[model samples]
Target: MKLTLKIWRQNGPEEKGEMVDYQVSDISEDMSFLEMIDVLNEGIIDGSIDDKGNYGPVAFDHDCREGICGMCSMYINGEAHGPGRGVTTCQLHMREFNDGETIYIEPWRSKAFPIVKDLVTDRSSFDRIMQAGGYVSVNTSGNTQDGNAIPIPKENADWAFDAATCIGCGACVASCKNSSAMLFVSAKVTQLSLLPQGDVERNRRVKNMVKQMDEEGFGNCTNTGACEVECPKGISLKNIARMNQEYLKASFTTE
Candidate 1:
């Protein structure tokens, strides 16, 4: 199928950007979104599509194209990861669009995720937020406690597992009107707070991560629920509620 793509192009974070249009043909419906872009880039590099000159291939982030990495983040047609539920851009298929259609693609827009180039944004802010707390302290001096030694409720274990599915894709922030990272942060918080293994630093983890989230320029969540809706992993809004509870308890108890 032939298609028109209007993709955002920027040389660097400080450089001006704009939408550039291109025409691509013979695209397979089975091709993943990133694969389709690969075809487009090939055309651009070979000077087949753009006759003016070699405009260079479009720059976008991708790793582990199986969708486990969440590096293929893109705002397509005004929706995060294109028009889909519980899927990342790498998992999105070209069949989702019709023949002769025009697709608009852009990078995640947020103060914390400044664009590094075309479709690639510096999501290291997420790495920093994770560094602030998203871990559990444990003793490893040959006296490590067995994780299975402590029996945990099935419900809590299931919830913790669900929260752990978050891939930190930033769809939660991209879809939010305020560009809030609450859903991502909350998922990380709940993933540990519900498990005994994470109990030791539960209170402190919430405090530091939330503080670092704010310092990273992420906006506050106002219960709009966009983050939950747009999350590729279907991370629940319940995690946010749990995070708030943990934060409040930590604020009062933890010095």
Candidate 2:
């Protein structure tokens, strides 16, 4: 199949960017979206598709194309990870588009996640948010509690597991009108807050992480629910509710 791709191109963080169009043919419907891009890059590198005098290959992030890493984040056709439910860009297939369709691709847009190049944004803001307090500080120096020793309710365990599935893909932010990271932060908070291992620092954890999230320039969530809808892992909006409750409780209890 032949297709037209209008992709964003930027040289560096401070450089101006714009949409550049290219044509690709003989694409397999079975190929993943990234694989299709690979074909385009190949054409560009070989000067076969060089209409704009060879701007080099498009720069997009990808690792573990199986969708486990969430690194293949792309805003395609105005939707995060393209037009799909519960799937990352790497998992998106070429068949989702018509044979002669024109696809528009861009990177995640947020102040906190500034673009490093074409289609590649610096998401280290997420890493910083996680570092603020997304883990348990339990002493495991031979005094580790046995996994079976903790009598956790199955309901809580399931909810925590669901929350833990968040891959930090930033779709939650990209889809939000405000570019909020609330859904991502809430999922991180819920995963730990529901578990016994994370009980020790619950109040402080919420306080620190939320503070850091704000410091990172992420916008506040106004319950528009876009984050929950676009999340590749389907992380629920309920986690945001839980996070709010935790934050309020932490404000009162945490010094």
Candidate 3:
């Protein structure tokens, strides 16, 4: 099968980027999109064509191509990752594509996640948000309570675990039109709100994280489920709603 990759190319952050086309022939339909790009890079390295040295290697991001890490992010074929409801590009298989297809690839385009190079964007904004007290501040004194001692309801425990599954991949920012991290922010908020260990600093966590999220230039959540739908973890938008309740309560209560 043959595929035409229309990929975004930019020399630097300040430079303008445009879509550049390349034809990939003999591509197996079974090969993942990243795998196909790898093959293209190998061909370029092998000097398969004259003046190949003039052509730059295709750039993208991917560490655990197994979908566990949300680091492998890209706008594939106009979708967040690809033609999937809740999946990352790494987990996205090539089987969903067809022969002689023209695939468009772009990085996570967001103000908070500016493009560093090709498909790689800087997501330290997320790190900073987490740093703004997304954790509990307490002595890890070896004298701790037993795991089963806390009688948390099954439903709450399940929700807490689900929220903890967020991989911090920044796909929520990528898919959002406002480039908001509300879903990601909300997930973190809910994860702590539902857990016993996460209390003590619950009020502080929501305030700090929300403040940092706003400072990062993320937009407000307007009930659009794009963030949750594009999230590879299938993070529920319900978490955002829960966050809204928390934020409202936190806003009125004095520390």
Candidate 4:
């Protein structure tokens, strides 16, 4: 198989980026996207790119290419993590593409997620959001309540678990026209606030998390489902609505 890659390249966070094209031959369809890039990088390492060293080996953020870590993020062929559904970029194999195809690879584009290099962006914004109070403040030593007797409403428990599946990959922001992080924030807020432990600090948690989300400079969500479609976890936009309700209610009820 042969394909052309138009990959975005940037020197640093402040540097302007552009797409550069390269063609490779005899690519195996079974090769993962990263593996194909590895092959391309090998060719690049074999030499320099003109006098500017432009065509050097490519760089992209990747940790655990197996898709469990959600670090392998890329916008391939105008889609988040390529055409695969409900899967991370690392799990995307080349089989999804056709021979003699031209693939456009770009990084997650958002002001909050500024580019660090060729294809890697600073995703620490998510960590900071979590730090701003995404978790339960209650610190349990040991021997809490009996799990079975908690009597957690089945609907609440299920919804919370679904929301917890979010892996914090920035695909939601990347694919959203407004680059909003509402879905991600909603997932965290919904997951925590739905439970009894999380209810104690519900008002506080929602306030801090929403504040952190806004501070990160992500845009607002107008109910576009693009984030849900691109999310590797298929996190629903319903959570965003839930978060909105929670935040508004907290604003009125909390001291």
TM-score for all predictions? 0.98, 0.98, 0.94, 0.94
Model 2: lDDT equals 0.93
Per residue, candidate 1 scores C-alpha lDDT tens digits across 1-255 of 999999998888998988989999999999999999999999988878882323479999999999889899999999999998889999999999999999999999999999999999999999999999999887799988888998999999999999999999899999999999999999999999899989889999999999999999999899999888889999999999999999999999978
* Candidate 3 Cα lDDT to native: 0.83
Q: Model 2: which residue pairs collide?
A: none
C-alpha lDDT of candidate 4 relative to the true structure = 0.88
Which predicted model would earn the best TM-score? Answer: 2
Predictions in order: lDDT = 0.93, 0.93, 0.83, 0.88
- Please report, as a residue range, the 10-residue window in candidate 3 with the lowest summed lDDT: 47-56
lDDT, model 4, position 67: 79
Candidate 3 lDDT tens digits, 111-137: 888888778888999999999978866
- Candidate 4: tens digits of C-alpha lDDT, residues 40-81: 887777752221346477889888888778798899999888
Query: What would the per-residue lDDT of candidate 2 be over residues 18-88, giving only the tens digit for each residue?
Result: 99999999999999999999999999988888647345999999999998897988999999999988999
- For model 3, name the residue pairs that clash: none
Q: Can you give the lDDT of residue 234 in candidate 2? A: 98
